[model samples]
Target: MTTYFTKDHEYLRVEGDTATVGITDYAQSQLGDVVFVELPAVGQSFKQGAEAAVVESVKAASDVYAPVSGEVVAVNDKLPDNPATINEDPEGAGWFMKIRLADKGELDKLMDEAAYKAMVG
Candidate 1:
Protein backbone atom coordinates (compact mmCIF):
# COMPACT_ATOMS: atom_id res chain seq x y z
CA MET A 1 0.00 0.00 0.00
CA THR A 2 1.09 3.57 -0.71
CA THR A 3 0.08 6.62 1.26
CA TYR A 4 -0.32 10.21 0.14
CA PHE A 5 -1.27 13.44 1.81
CA THR A 6 -3.03 16.67 0.93
CA LYS A 7 -1.86 20.12 1.97
CA ASP A 8 -5.06 20.36 3.99
CA HIS A 9 -3.67 17.57 6.25
CA GLU A 10 -5.72 14.57 5.10
CA TYR A 11 -4.12 11.21 4.27
CA LEU A 12 -5.00 8.46 1.83
CA ARG A 13 -3.73 4.91 2.16
CA VAL A 14 -4.16 3.31 -1.22
CA GLU A 15 -4.32 -0.43 -1.67
CA GLY A 16 -5.60 -1.53 -5.07
CA ASP A 17 -8.41 0.70 -6.36
CA THR A 18 -9.65 1.58 -2.88
CA ALA A 19 -8.02 3.96 -0.45
CA THR A 20 -8.53 4.43 3.26
CA VAL A 21 -8.97 8.06 4.29
CA GLY A 22 -8.29 10.00 7.46
CA ILE A 23 -6.98 13.19 8.99
CA THR A 24 -3.30 13.26 9.92
CA ASP A 25 -1.78 13.02 13.38
CA TYR A 26 -0.61 16.60 13.07
CA ALA A 27 -4.16 17.67 12.35
CA GLN A 28 -5.56 15.91 15.40
CA SER A 29 -2.91 17.53 17.57
CA GLN A 30 -3.76 20.94 16.21
CA LEU A 31 -7.46 20.39 16.74
CA GLY A 32 -7.08 19.62 20.45
CA ASP A 33 -9.56 16.94 21.54
CA VAL A 34 -12.05 15.83 18.94
CA VAL A 35 -15.70 16.00 19.98
CA PHE A 36 -17.39 14.74 16.83
CA VAL A 37 -16.87 13.73 13.21
CA GLU A 38 -19.41 13.98 10.40
CA LEU A 39 -18.39 11.40 7.82
CA PRO A 40 -19.40 10.89 4.22
CA ALA A 41 -21.85 8.16 3.31
CA VAL A 42 -20.90 5.13 1.26
CA GLY A 43 -21.37 5.57 -2.50
CA GLN A 44 -20.96 9.35 -2.31
CA SER A 45 -18.52 10.68 -4.85
CA PHE A 46 -16.17 13.60 -4.20
CA LYS A 47 -13.52 15.52 -6.08
CA GLN A 48 -10.00 15.88 -4.89
CA GLY A 49 -9.67 18.75 -2.43
CA ALA A 50 -13.38 18.82 -1.72
CA GLU A 51 -14.55 18.56 1.86
CA ALA A 52 -15.23 14.91 2.60
CA ALA A 53 -15.79 15.08 6.33
CA VAL A 54 -16.13 17.52 9.22
CA VAL A 55 -14.35 17.20 12.56
CA GLU A 56 -15.29 19.25 15.57
CA SER A 57 -12.88 19.82 18.44
CA VAL A 58 -12.78 21.91 21.56
CA LYS A 59 -10.82 24.52 19.66
CA ALA A 60 -12.86 24.67 16.45
CA ALA A 61 -14.46 22.77 13.59
CA SER A 62 -12.34 21.69 10.61
CA ASP A 63 -12.96 20.10 7.25
CA VAL A 64 -11.19 16.94 6.11
CA TYR A 65 -10.57 17.13 2.38
CA ALA A 66 -10.26 14.37 -0.16
CA PRO A 67 -6.68 13.58 -1.12
CA VAL A 68 -7.94 12.12 -4.39
CA SER A 69 -11.22 12.03 -6.31
CA GLY A 70 -13.26 8.90 -5.66
CA GLU A 71 -16.53 7.32 -4.53
CA VAL A 72 -16.77 6.48 -0.86
CA VAL A 73 -17.18 2.75 -0.21
CA ALA A 74 -17.30 2.69 3.58
CA VAL A 75 -16.93 4.86 6.68
CA ASN A 76 -15.90 4.24 10.27
CA ASP A 77 -19.02 4.09 12.40
CA LYS A 78 -17.03 4.11 15.63
CA LEU A 79 -16.45 7.85 15.36
CA PRO A 80 -19.80 9.33 16.37
CA ASP A 81 -19.99 7.11 19.45
CA ASN A 82 -16.34 7.62 20.35
CA PRO A 83 -14.90 10.71 18.77
CA ALA A 84 -11.90 10.71 21.07
CA THR A 85 -10.57 7.71 19.14
CA ILE A 86 -9.44 10.19 16.50
CA ASN A 87 -7.26 11.91 19.06
CA GLU A 88 -5.84 8.60 20.24
CA ASP A 89 -5.23 7.05 16.83
CA PRO A 90 -5.81 9.44 13.98
CA GLU A 91 -4.25 7.22 11.33
CA GLY A 92 -5.38 3.77 12.43
CA ALA A 93 -8.69 2.88 14.07
CA GLY A 94 -9.64 6.51 13.57
CA TRP A 95 -9.64 6.29 9.77
CA PHE A 96 -12.69 8.09 8.34
CA MET A 97 -13.59 6.23 5.17
CA LYS A 98 -12.58 4.17 2.14
CA ILE A 99 -12.98 5.27 -1.48
CA ARG A 100 -12.73 3.71 -4.89
CA LEU A 101 -10.30 5.99 -6.72
CA ALA A 102 -11.57 7.76 -9.82
CA ASP A 103 -8.22 8.99 -11.12
CA LYS A 104 -5.02 7.34 -9.98
CA GLY A 105 -3.06 10.30 -11.33
CA GLU A 106 -4.49 12.49 -8.61
CA LEU A 107 -2.40 10.58 -6.06
CA ASP A 108 0.72 11.93 -7.73
CA LYS A 109 -0.37 15.46 -6.93
CA LEU A 110 -0.26 14.80 -3.19
CA MET A 111 2.67 15.06 -0.82
CA ASP A 112 4.90 12.12 0.06
CA GLU A 113 5.75 11.39 3.68
CA ALA A 114 8.96 13.42 3.49
CA ALA A 115 7.31 16.39 1.84
CA TYR A 116 4.39 16.24 4.27
CA LYS A 117 6.76 16.10 7.26
CA ALA A 118 8.66 19.12 6.02
CA MET A 119 5.47 21.06 5.39
CA VAL A 120 4.12 20.21 8.85
CA GLY A 121 7.39 21.31 10.41
Candidate 2:
Protein backbone atom coordinates (compact mmCIF):
# COMPACT_ATOMS: atom_id res chain seq x y z
CA MET A 1 0.00 0.00 0.00
CA THR A 2 1.13 3.54 -0.76
CA THR A 3 0.24 6.18 1.78
CA TYR A 4 -0.47 9.75 0.75
CA PHE A 5 -1.26 12.83 2.79
CA THR A 6 -3.03 16.12 2.35
CA LYS A 7 -1.90 19.46 3.76
CA ASP A 8 -5.05 19.33 5.90
CA HIS A 9 -3.52 16.33 7.72
CA GLU A 10 -5.60 13.53 6.27
CA TYR A 11 -3.98 10.28 5.13
CA LEU A 12 -5.01 7.95 2.35
CA ARG A 13 -3.55 4.46 2.23
CA VAL A 14 -3.98 3.20 -1.26
CA GLU A 15 -3.99 -0.46 -2.12
CA GLY A 16 -5.06 -1.23 -5.65
CA ASP A 17 -8.16 0.82 -6.52
CA THR A 18 -9.30 1.25 -2.91
CA ALA A 19 -7.93 3.55 -0.25
CA THR A 20 -8.32 3.61 3.51
CA VAL A 21 -8.71 7.08 4.96
CA GLY A 22 -7.87 8.68 8.33
CA ILE A 23 -6.38 11.62 10.14
CA THR A 24 -2.67 11.67 10.93
CA ASP A 25 -1.20 11.28 14.42
CA TYR A 26 -0.32 14.93 14.47
CA ALA A 27 -3.90 15.84 13.60
CA GLN A 28 -5.44 13.73 16.37
CA SER A 29 -2.96 15.04 18.89
CA GLN A 30 -3.87 18.56 17.93
CA LEU A 31 -7.58 17.75 18.19
CA GLY A 32 -7.21 16.47 21.76
CA ASP A 33 -9.41 13.70 23.13
CA VAL A 34 -11.78 12.86 20.33
CA VAL A 35 -15.40 12.60 21.41
CA PHE A 36 -17.34 11.92 18.24
CA VAL A 37 -17.02 11.20 14.54
CA GLU A 38 -19.53 11.72 11.74
CA LEU A 39 -18.80 9.44 8.82
CA PRO A 40 -20.26 9.32 5.33
CA ALA A 41 -22.50 6.42 4.37
CA VAL A 42 -21.34 3.53 2.26
CA GLY A 43 -21.80 4.29 -1.44
CA GLN A 44 -21.65 8.03 -0.77
CA SER A 45 -19.35 9.85 -3.18
CA PHE A 46 -17.04 12.80 -2.65
CA LYS A 47 -14.85 14.83 -4.96
CA GLN A 48 -11.23 15.45 -4.19
CA GLY A 49 -10.80 18.03 -1.42
CA ALA A 50 -14.47 17.82 -0.46
CA GLU A 51 -15.56 17.27 3.15
CA ALA A 52 -15.91 13.57 3.70
CA ALA A 53 -16.33 13.36 7.47
CA VAL A 54 -16.38 15.36 10.68
CA VAL A 55 -14.37 14.77 13.84
CA GLU A 56 -15.15 16.27 17.20
CA SER A 57 -12.83 16.54 20.14
CA VAL A 58 -12.58 18.40 23.41
CA LYS A 59 -10.88 21.25 21.60
CA ALA A 60 -13.20 21.61 18.59
CA ALA A 61 -14.97 20.04 15.67
CA SER A 62 -12.96 19.60 12.46
CA ASP A 63 -13.77 18.61 8.92
CA VAL A 64 -11.96 15.66 7.36
CA TYR A 65 -11.48 16.11 3.65
CA ALA A 66 -11.08 13.65 0.86
CA PRO A 67 -7.50 13.31 -0.39
CA VAL A 68 -8.81 12.03 -3.70
CA SER A 69 -12.16 11.59 -5.37
CA GLY A 70 -13.96 8.37 -4.45
CA GLU A 71 -17.11 6.59 -3.29
CA VAL A 72 -17.31 5.41 0.31
CA VAL A 73 -17.26 1.64 0.50
CA ALA A 74 -17.06 1.26 4.27
CA VAL A 75 -16.92 3.33 7.45
CA ASN A 76 -15.63 2.59 10.93
CA ASP A 77 -18.73 2.15 13.08
CA LYS A 78 -16.69 1.89 16.28
CA LEU A 79 -15.90 5.63 16.30
CA PRO A 80 -19.16 7.26 17.45
CA ASP A 81 -19.18 5.15 20.64
CA ASN A 82 -15.42 5.29 21.15
CA PRO A 83 -13.90 8.23 19.40
CA ALA A 84 -10.68 7.99 21.33
CA THR A 85 -9.81 5.14 19.04
CA ILE A 86 -8.56 7.83 16.67
CA ASN A 87 -6.19 9.16 19.32
CA GLU A 88 -4.97 5.67 20.09
CA ASP A 89 -4.50 4.53 16.50
CA PRO A 90 -5.07 7.11 13.82
CA GLU A 91 -3.72 5.09 10.93
CA GLY A 92 -4.77 1.59 11.90
CA ALA A 93 -8.09 0.50 13.36
CA GLY A 94 -8.85 4.19 13.72
CA TRP A 95 -9.34 4.52 9.99
CA PHE A 96 -12.48 6.51 9.14
CA MET A 97 -13.45 4.91 5.85
CA LYS A 98 -12.58 2.89 2.77
CA ILE A 99 -13.19 4.34 -0.68
CA ARG A 100 -13.06 3.11 -4.22
CA LEU A 101 -11.18 5.83 -6.07
CA ALA A 102 -13.00 7.85 -8.67
CA ASP A 103 -9.99 9.44 -10.33
CA LYS A 104 -6.48 7.99 -10.00
CA GLY A 105 -4.92 11.21 -11.27
CA GLU A 106 -6.00 13.00 -8.15
CA LEU A 107 -3.44 11.02 -6.19
CA ASP A 108 -0.73 13.06 -7.89
CA LYS A 109 -1.83 16.12 -5.98
CA LEU A 110 -1.18 14.52 -2.57
CA MET A 111 2.09 14.41 -0.67
CA ASP A 112 4.13 11.29 -0.11
CA GLU A 113 5.26 10.36 3.41
CA ALA A 114 8.56 12.23 3.31
CA ALA A 115 7.05 15.33 1.78
CA TYR A 116 4.25 15.31 4.30
CA LYS A 117 6.60 14.88 7.25
CA ALA A 118 8.73 17.78 6.12
CA MET A 119 5.72 19.92 5.36
CA VAL A 120 4.20 19.29 8.77
CA GLY A 121 7.46 19.92 10.55
**C-alpha positional error of residue 20 in candidate 1 after TM-score superposition, expressed in Å:** 0.5
TM-score, every prediction? 0.97, 0.97
Query: What is the Å distance of residue 37 in model 2 from its true position?
Result: 0.5
Worst 10 residues of 1 by lDDT: 59-68
Clashes of each: 0, 0
Query: In candidate 2, what are the lDDT values of residues 1-121, reduced to their tens digit?
Result: 8999999999999999999999999999899999999999999999888998999998899999888888999999988788999999999989999999998988998899999999978
Instruction: Give me the runs in candidate 2 sitting further than 4 Å from their true place.
Output: none
Return the top candidate by lDDT: 2
How many clashes show up in model 1? 0
Model 1 lDDT per residue over 1-121, tens place: 9888888988889999999999899999999999989999889999988988999999899888887888999999989899999999999999999999999988888898999999999
